[model samples]
Target: MARRGHHVGVNDTDPPLPAGTPLPPDELGHRLTEVFDLVGPLYRRALRKVEQGEAVEGASVGVRSVLDLLCRKGDLTVPQLSRIQALSRQFVQRMVNDAAAHGWVEVLPNPAHQRSSLIRITEEGRTLIATVLDREHSLNREVGGDLTDAEVRACVRVLREMLRTFDHVDVDD
Candidate 1:
């Protein structure tokens, strides 16, 4: 059973507003803060869930992220991955190192940059990520809210806007 204040899915805290309701700046800020509050817990919980899975038991979230990026974008330098993922170069390098140790990725000489090597996902890495993603997709299919595409799209828009608002802020590690 879910605990109090730990609702599994969406909670209707505030009533729906009219289609063209004019939101004051303070009200909008408050609403966005509520969204942010939920996002932090949701992300941590999701990471924990992913880590707990047997298929990906040994893969840390950071390592999985690096592998997924390489699988999707082909070989890329550590600096490029860092910039794309908005992570520090040192952190990304550590993740790459971990993946390489696990035989999930390989570092190759980059013709463009003699110093920064290109990171490529191995066949083993592709298989692992595919399994992880397939499991996630199966879990997502359980989200039975009868949600519409338009609603999901609107949610994506709001999240993207929230991200853009903080794009200028720097919290590099």
Candidate 2:
């Protein structure tokens, strides 16, 4: 049985390792699996929170993601956004359509690809995404963990390494 706040198959009863404890390469995979287990639920719950906050604006998590990407990366094609987000091109296209309907984003001509138009976040989109991100940041600041910058960086490094390991995996598959 799983303990509260823990996923099944991960033994949460075990005392946590001391800070900076050296983990053997083989054991590291098992520990990282626990991290992955927690990440799924964390992501879902976080998505729900964001969706709830965005209810007033009628933006789903997917649309927010598309808008945020366009805001950060300037303009990009649906295929480019799909690849960057590891989502299907069709799904991304739907998101772009939703954003366009809200006047948050615009479809511009892509000189590089006649078939694929570039998606740009309009001024309205930029403002909405900025507000969303600001709210998220404020919520993030309320996280109870007294985590230091080094600890957060280490967490990011671990997540990045995990992402890189699966970078070659086809999302469509």
Candidate 3:
């Protein structure tokens, strides 16, 4: 039995809208539909490509996220990776395991702690990240080429600020 809030796949049914309502630009419905439109197909295509092994080094987004973190921050222990990524320690460890197995990362002994290991990107990992990053840059340019670099940076800053605000918002009973 699936746990509560653990359902997978799409919900095909649509929700009813208010009668004669002019939907607010930032309404949940508008945002959801926009997310579905942009992310749904991208998710499907990325999944298909991964399944076909077109992108081999970073097979999963979670793994790629970790690699990107390591690329920017250098070596990190599992606990550090978990904290930085806001992921479960087990989850980060799994990515680390996969990365280690594929020669994408190297696990070095942590001098401070005998039981813990620090992971650093290998040369192969850096090479793969360079390729992935180049592709990501091209995709970003295709999507946001109209925006000036400064405008794009400003938009990113604003979006991140919004995210931070939402993170602090408490649920109302």
Candidate 4:
């Protein structure tokens, strides 16, 4: 039996919104704002933990994000990575530059794109990311105790769907 406030795959405070139902702009804004308010702090805290032992050089969240990606996704051109991460090219470029300065990544000439360079992770970066992730497991266990694995998986799926829908919806129109 699920505990109160521990329901899987649905909000506990309210009934589930109907499929294909569009919320009023104000209501949608309010819910999204609430989510950001709650989720943003968690992200910041985790990022801080990941950076704790990192060298002061290139230790900004932006640089860490680039290093994390390069370490996980193998080599990628700047634009390709920017698109995949849903970040602007300029912002990613700056992060990439910082990572390069710290020897966490290497920028090699891209054969297909003369201008965009391929960014690859260095051994040092991999080791550092590994260390961060090793710690993250404990953090995950600490926070995830409130939810069952099924509930967590369902929540992640719903969040991904919401992000996909947001990508298609144009708020201004």
Candidate 3 colliding pairs: none
Model 1's number of clashes is 0
lDDT of 2 by residue, 59-171 (tens): 88999999888888889999999999999898999999999999999999999999999999999998898888998899998998789999899999999998898889777
Give lDDT for model 1.
0.82
TM-score of each model, paired residue for residue: 0.82, 0.86, 0.62, 0.71
Give lDDT per model, in order.
Answer: 0.82, 0.86, 0.69, 0.72
- CA lDDT of 167 in candidate 2? 89
**What is candidate 3's lDDT per residue for 1-173, written digit by digit as tens?**
43222223222334435665644544544444554576679778765654444355545666676777889999989988887666778888999898888788999999988888989998888877777767667655667447788876865765565456555443321
Best by TM-score: 2
RMSD of candidates 1 onward, in order: 5.8, 4.1, 9.8, 6.6
**Candidates 1 and 2, the one with greater lDDT:** 2
Evaluate residue 45 in candidate 1 and report its C-alpha lDDT on the 0 to 100 scale.
88
State the local distance difference test value for candidate 2.
0.86
Runs off by more than 4 Å, candidate 1: 1-22, 54-57
lDDT of 1 at 112: 88
User: What TM-score should be assigned to candidate 2?
Assistant: 0.86
Residue 112, model 1: Cα distance from true site in angstroms: 2.1
Residue-level error in angstroms, candidate 4, position 77: 1.2
lDDT of 2 at 116: 98
